[model samples]
Target chain A: DAGITQSPRHKVTETGTPVTLRCHQTENHRYMYWYRQDPGHGLRLIHYSYGVKDTDKGEVSDGYSVSRSKTEDFLLTLESATSSQTSVYFCAIRPQRPSRGTGELFFGEGSRLTVL
Target chain B: AQTVTQSQPEMSVQEAETVTLSCTYDTSESDYYLFWYKQPPSRQMILVIRQEAYKQQNATENRFSVNFQKAAKSFSLKISDSQLGDAAMYFCAYWSQGGSEKLVFGKGTKLTVNP
Candidate 1:
């Protein structure tokens, strides 16, 4: 609904392989985030980009890296995929600034990744 | 860092009845926002309601309303006239006004509406 799209909606790869999940947004929002959902864990932030080339690590940023080369795209890469990394990844965008104290984020459908 | 807590792992309510989902957070910041998002089987996160910390009055959207107690740091969602379509996993999240850009979320509470 946020003009956000995720590539490889479903992926199945073997361990030790490299995987990248792409999140592209048409809205060109300033903020983009990567979150993974697992049973009993709800959702945890992996990484987020506030602007082009600006990225920050989240609580569970281990073994995961992100790159935002353009305003409309954010990429999440796993150098070496592991079975523990198998989870549903989500992409979300926040409009403008949060100083206004209000604004709900729009999220993409999600990308389900499985490691064999 | 702020953390959210959803004590109930799952809840059940009969059709046309009412149900409440409990959420609490630990934060030292006074200015912030709270949100409730619903994720159905389709896995799409839909905004159910939002509450602003500065506003004393509770926030409501149609049949969905939030009872926010800033002092107690408890935000509970009340659903009236629960329908089968209301069955989904609900998440409670928090965001600071001028601080943290991250929107921290709780584990989640799954709601089941029985016919």
Candidate 2:
């Protein structure tokens, strides 16, 4: 329990629709990541933010975008949802302090999305 | 780039028995970290154990222990006295030392603890 929360624990949207999932953290960690879990692919990174307004694409960033306006919130938006985008999305945070070089990630419960 | 592999897709162990999950990773970096995570039906990703590649000594946490062979590039997790609560999907992950905060994870191994 790293004080991380994700909104819309479960969602179902039609294809070509817009969907956004929110992740909020109270720990004030400097690094946040968005990952999607599929059956065979495991968990693939979608996007991550190292600091406020500083975000980068991940392995599976197509059709997905992310924003980190402040230290506590990171939002993942699907420009136009597709059936292939249906999966469980997880939000993770890590302490960016140089002292913590281990790079351990504390993850939120998860948000399950269904694009039909 | 780093890649982790978990050969076993699923495994089972009788209650109180021991079970081991295998993991192998590919990385050119000499220094890095390895981890094991558990995701139950609840879908919460929980850290089960971790090992630093530089540490010769294996890492252990209560009933969970990791056999980390830096030379073999293998990190395996052994669970003792497996409990029903341990039934879940287990993942092997890797993170480079002193690099980006990104973590690469394996496909995962689903473990079942039978009563």
Candidate 3:
């Protein structure tokens, strides 16, 4: 538990509405990632940030966006929610240059979002 | 792009028994890393074991161990002396050596431990 926290542990929003999930870390890790967990998809990367103000798209980035203004916070937003966007969103962080190729990833509890 | 695959969707084991979960991946890069993550009902993802592709020796952590087959692109997790706490969804993940350090995970295999 690297002091990672995800806000709105559970949420329900109507379709076409915008939604944002926040991830906060206290470890000051340089890398942060956002992933959505679906029933059959496991965990699919939605977006990731390497440093402050640096962000990149992931495998399932089509309907999502992320921003990291500070090293401790990363936010994932859905411009317009969709039914398919309903899933458990997770935030992960890894210390800069993980040693020994272990590439350890610390994950938040998770945020469950539903779209109606 | 790297991909991880877990062939078994569900598995069961009895207490004090040994159980192995299979995982395979597709990667062109020779030097990379593999990991097994466990997510219990608590919904928190915990790292169980990790293996480096370059290392021929398998990695073990307590009751958990990994059988890393670099040539076959196979990484499997074996849990010995299984306990009820071992019942969880196990995920296989892959990460490249360089760049963003993003992880690609498999669908996961649910492990049920029967007392």
Could you say which candidate leads in lDDT? 1
User: Model 1: number of clashes?
Assistant: 0
User: In model 3 chain B, where is the ten-residue run with the lowest total lDDT?
Assistant: B95-104
Tell me the tens digit of each residue's lDDT in model 2 across B1-114. 788999999999999999999999999999898999999998889989878888999999999999988879999999999999999999999999757668999999999999
Instruction: Give stretches of model 3 more than 4 Å off.
Output: A97-102
Instruction: Name the best candidate (by DockQ).
Output: 2
TM-score, prediction 2: 0.97
Using DockQ, rank the candidates from best to worst. Answer: 2, 3, 1
Candidate 2, position B26, lDDT: 93
- What DockQ does every candidate get? 0.79, 0.83, 0.82
Positional deviation of residue A69's Cα in model 2 after best superposition, in angstroms? 1.1
- TM-score, every prediction: 0.97, 0.97, 0.96
lDDT of each: 0.95, 0.93, 0.92
Per-model TM-score (chain A alone):
0.94, 0.95, 0.94
Indicate the docking level reached by candidate 2: high
Query: How many Å off is the CA of A58 in candidate 3?
Result: 0.3
Off-target runs (Cα >4 Å) in candidate 2 are: A97-101
